[model samples]
Target: MVTFAIGTDDFVVAGALPAISRDLAVSEGTTGQLVTVFSLAYAFSAPVMAVLTSRVPPRRLLGLGLTLFAALNFATALATSFEILLVLRIVTAVVAGTLSPAAFAIAGQRAEPGYAGRAIGVVAAGLTVSLAVGVPIGTWLSTRWGWHATFVAVGVFTVGALVTVAATLPRFEPVSEAGIGDRLRALRSPAILACAVTTTIGACAGLMPYIYVAPISEALTARPELLTVFIATIGVAGALGAAVGGHIADGWGPDRGMIATFGTALVVVLVWVGLHATVAPVPPVVIMGSLAVWGVAAWSNNAPMNARTLALAGPVGTEAMALNTSGLYVGMACGSAIGGLVLDRFGVTGTLLAAIGIGVCGVAAMVISVRRWPTGRPARGKAGKKARV
Candidate 1:
């Protein structure tokens, strides 16, 4: 639920950009910076905050982070100017950065011996489900009641998440006993570094075309309403894929899971590009089918990535998870920027083609990483002394 709320808050603003621009008397381009700044802020802050708050208990930190998140959303809804809203978005993003990694760490730590992948999958699915469920609902509420209402709704959802987490989550001390220097040193491991690189590249590839999905959809279909259907389809498929990916990670090992999912994603993107380039007037069913596969392939990679990071990082898994989260947001920001540039230089076809190239690079990176660390086992140095699993 906390993941769901934070995901909703991250995505809901895109849907409300136009309304926000009109209300705040700013250009749509200017209003869009809110989304950009949030992503950048979250990307940069996650690892830093994780280290700074290393001594804080997970449950206490989660409660405090969610509380601040809720308050920020409410304050955002009340802000009168674009400047204030932008700052609020940045601050809210920092709070969210603090919450998400802790949530993942808790989920990973609490699970039984072999089931950590599935447990992490369940939590990661919240973000995908938000795309399917929360964003659409928030978008509708904003459309009807004004953009401010969307923030209010997210705030209310956050409160619910806060209460649920506080009641159900166990109180646990920090997972890693490493000093700040040791925590930073964990990033030096080959497997951890590879996992981080693959995560960043995979996220970049997955989100590049998605950020400009509207344009791609418009080019492929005449019906405007199908846009909503397409987004919802990806979200739903992504949620299912996340679960399946986690199960695969548990059964097949995280390395194979990453390889298979990323390889599948490469094919899916290639097919999408082919469909756009060769077929004139692509069938709606074909488009939907392609999107469903793309979503599954794209989102399924997340679980294995998380599992692999946790497996490799050992005692500092939480800090590694924080870095992974940062990579995701950074990739997202880069994807958006790169996608926009490609869209401007070339048409929608070019954008789809660019996604294919990016997906290929991501797959190669995963393959290289897995080959280097065949078993996806924990490291053997000082990092392994207090390994969680």
Candidate 2:
């Protein structure tokens, strides 16, 4: 739930960008800074927080992080200046970064030995759930009330998450055996680096259209509210896909499932573009159909990739997963930023073409890396089991 707050905190800002910009006397361009700053802080602080608190108790860290997150949400609600709001959002993410990794590490320690895939999927689902429930609901409420009210609501929920965690969350015993150097050593491995790149490319392709989905709907669809409908539908698809992906990761292995899924997602997005332009009044419904297919293809790979990294790093699984998780966000931030640039340089059609192109590049990177896999033989007979443990 704390992680859910973190995920929603970032996305809700996106949905309210138009409102925030107008109220704050800033450009819609500038309002996106809120999201950029938070993601930057999150990406930069996550690994460091994990390593620095390598010996700290998990429940303590989680509690501290959520408390700070709640405080930051209040700060955002009370912010009178854009500069202060920006700074606070960044600081909020720095503090909140501890939750995702710490929570996963804690969950892994508690999960049934063979149920690692299912356990981490639930943790990862917090991210999905944020998009599925938190962001959309927050956006609707923000539209009804003022944007400040949205922050206040989120702050209230953060307080609730903090309290629940304080009461029910179990204490985590930290293992401090690995030095910073050992964590650094894993990044030097070609296979690990390959996994990280796959994360980046995959997120890039996924986010290109996602960043501007609302705008696309406004431009292409007759009914504007249908934007929310498509987003809601896509959210449901992603959640279901993530669940299926977790199961496949536990069984078929990560690399094959993720790589194949990415390839399929490329097709879905391109098809969505055509459906939107040519399908006339029924575009939203068609797009929603495409989204359901895309969601499964896109999200199903998340858990498998994480599980794959756990297998890849062996004893260093926790650290690798932390970095990989951070890598995914880096991909999201960079992808959205690049997508914005593409939108600026070219129209929406051009943006669609660009997204399609990146999707292809991303797919190529995964295929080549998997086939040539820097330092391992592919699993025999198991067609989609290239993930090495």
Candidate 3:
């Protein structure tokens, strides 16, 4: 529930950019910084928080983080200037940064043996759900009421999530063995580094087109109302992909799952680009279908990749997942920034092609990781066998 609320808060901004810009008297480009700054701050701060809070009880940290998240969102609802909103976003990012790694670590720690990937996937799926359901609802509400109403809605959701957590969540012992140095050392592992590279590239590919999806939809459909449908399709596909990815990772292993998903995404993007470039009077169904396919392939890699990070880091899975989270946000920041730049210099086709190229690099990295290191989980053929341990 906490994740669901935070995820909504993070993604709902994308759909509300026009309303926010009109209200605040800022360019839509400036409003885009809200996504970039929040991502950058969260990326850089998460690892530090993971190490600092390693010894704090999970329930305490989780509660405090959720409280801060709600408060900051409420504050965001009241902001009168763009600058104020940006600053508040940064603070909210830091608080959000604290919550995710802890939640993932808890999921990792508590999952049944051989089912860790499934647990992590459920948690991660919250973001995709926000993308699919929350963002659209928020966008519609913003259009009807105001962007302020959207933020208030997120705050309200968080309050409900907080109550649920307080009532149902179990207490967890501190990860006293984890330390800053231990966390840093995990990054030096070749497999871990490869996973991070894959994360960056895959995320870049997925988000680059996403940052400008509204305009892309407008170009394709020429009907502004259809933008909601496109957004909803992407979200729904992504949500399904995330859920399926977890089950696959639990069975076949995270590394192989990433390889498959990234490879598939690359193919889907190539087809999308070709159809988009060549098909004059392109059918709306074709464009929407491609977007949905791309969404599934791109998003399905998330949980498996995180599960792989945990497998690689062993005892420091919490710290490793923190690093993984950082990599994701960094990619998001870069993708959004670069997408904006590409939009300015070359236009939408250039942005799409750039993402396709990045997707190829991500696939190559995952390939190398699989060949060079033994992935900790079983292969698809060997899945469901009893553990040797």
lDDT of each: 0.80, 0.70, 0.79
Candidate 3 clash pair list: none
lDDT of 1 by residue, 1-389 (tens): 89999988987765665578688897544555576678789989999998899899987898888999999999989988888888999999999999999888878876666677878898889888987987767767766788889899889989989999889877778867899999888767777777777887887777766666656876776554566677778889989998998788877888888888877877877777777777746778888898899889878888888988888788898888988888888777767666666776787788778777877888888888888876653223342232242
Model 1: which ten-residue window has the lowest total lDDT? 378-387
Local lDDT at 244 for model 2 = 82
Order of candidate numbers by TM-score, starting with the best: 3, 1, 2
> Per-residue lDDT for 170-214 in model 3, tens only?
776964376678777875777777776768777878777777777
Which scores higher on lDDT, 2 or 3? 3
Model 2: residues with Cα > 4 Å off, grouped in runs: 25-30, 109-114, 277-281, 372-389
Q: List the lowest-lDDT window of 10 residues for candidate 2.
A: 380-389
For all predicted structures, in order, the TM-scores are 0.89, 0.88, 0.92
CA lDDT of 372 in candidate 1? 82
What is the model-wide C-alpha lDDT for candidate 1?
Answer: 0.80
